[model samples]
Target: MDYRRLEKIKRILQRRQPDLTLITDNVNNFRNLSAIIRSCEAVGTMEVHLVNNQQEKLYLINKVTAGAERWLTQTRHSSIVTGINHLKKRGFTIYATHLGDPEGICCAVRTLDYRKMDYTKPTAFVVGSEKKGISEEALENADYHISIPMMGMTQSLNVSVATAIILFEAQRQREEKGYYQQLRTSQEIYEKTIFEWAYP
Candidate 1:
């Protein structure tokens, strides 16, 4: 690789947050999944976890992902419970997206403002399927239920849009904490990732 391109890859790898990630629960739509992956990449997220119980395989739309999937490491799980358990074992704090107290009815899990949460720590945002929202199991497993406040008549945002919003908020917080100014990934992984990203 040329010096400029190699340097560019190193710069990006330097800012990558290995601890910040996303976990999707049965988000079957390939377009939505692709967009989520793209957003994760934009925010310097190095990996993403997926729960795809309904389908045998998960596919991505190249047009939506815009080649961002190639730069990310994706882990697929058979169920949301399995995915949550895996992340929890790794010391990741789970933040499941949920709109609690809809129509004045109290939800079992209370919701917090997404902006208020600390994203600089090892964090994972759990976004649910487009149709059903987050499953009960995911909500129960999450360390906290978070939501983006809606102002108008609309009740919810698109899965991809919501994912982007939350991920960017994390980017904002991480930026303020100077997390992007230095290399957070280990030296071995940093060298490996930059080489792969440059060569691939």
Candidate 2:
């Protein structure tokens, strides 16, 4: 690779947040999925978990993703429960996006101001399908239910747009914490990723 391309790859790798991630709960729309992956990549997210029981194959629109999916590690789960369990085992604090009353179902999980939460921790955001919001299982398994305050008549934003908003907020918080300035990934993984990105 050229020196410029190598340097750019290294710079992006240094900013990658290995601890921050996202989970999609049956987001079937290819355009939305691709856009969500693009936003995740823009925010330096290293991995994304997908839970789609309907289709075995996950498709992405190349135009929407803009090749961003190539750099991210995408894992498919059989169910939302399985996905949540996997993340929980890996020490990821999941934040599910929901618009309903925080205390409607149960008081255990309360909706918090998205900006107030600490994104510096090992965090993962869960977004559901376009038609339906997050599943009950996801909300139950999530560490917190978060929502963006809406001012206008529209109840919620588009799935991809909301994902971008939340991810950018996380990017901002992580940047303030100096998380992007230093390499958070392990040396072995970093070297392997750099090799793959530079060569592929």
Candidate 3:
């Protein structure tokens, strides 16, 4: 590999957020997944978790991702519960998107605006399928609910778009905290990711 390219990859990997990640629940649409992956890469998030139970197998759409899939680390879980538990064990505070009126609903989670919470913490944002929304298991497993405010008649944004919005907000918060200035990842991970990104 070229020295200049390797140095660039090293610089990027140094800022990769080990504390931040994403968990997508049954988001079967390839375009949405691809867009989400692209946004994740743009924001310096290196890891993404997925829970796909439906017929659709997770695959990268190169055109949609613009080749971002090769750079990200994707972890697939058997179910939402498994994914949630795994993150919890890693000391990450998981926030799942819940965009509905909780009135007349049992076990209604307290939803907060995305900006209200501190995104600089070790966190994982969870998004669900477009049609079904988030699963009950995900809601119960998540530490908090995050909602994106909308003014128009439409109550929700597409899953990929929503993920991008939330993640960018996180990036902004981390930037303010100077999270991007130095290496956040451990030595082993930083070296490994740099090697993979450069060689793969």
Using lDDT, give the best candidate's number.
Answer: 1
Better of 1 and 2 by TM-score: 1
Which candidate has the top score in TM-score?
1
Question: What does the lDDT read for residue 58 in candidate 2?
Answer: 82
lDDT for 50 (candidate 2): 94
- Candidates in order have lDDT scores of 0.91, 0.90, 0.88
* Candidate 2 lDDT, 25-137, residue by residue in tens: 99998899999999999999999999998888888999999999999999999999999889999898999987754444534435877877999999999999989889999
lDDT of 1 by residue, 94-179 (tens): 99998764233546546788888999899999999889999999988999888887777877899999999999999999999999
The Cα error of candidate 1 at residue 15, in Å, is: 0.4
TM-score list, all predictions:
0.95, 0.94, 0.93
Q: Look at candidate 1 and tell me the lDDT of residue 127.
A: 98
TM value for model 1: 0.95
Report the lDDT tens digits of candidate 3 across residue range 82-188. 99999999999999997954342433555778888898989999999999999998999899888887677997899999999999999999999999998998899
| lDDT-better candidate, 1 vs 3 | 1
Task: Arrange candidates, best TM-score first.
Answer: 1, 2, 3
Worst 10 residues of 2 by lDDT: 100-109
Q: Of 2 and 3, which scores higher on lDDT?
A: 2
Error of 2 at 89 (Å): 0.7
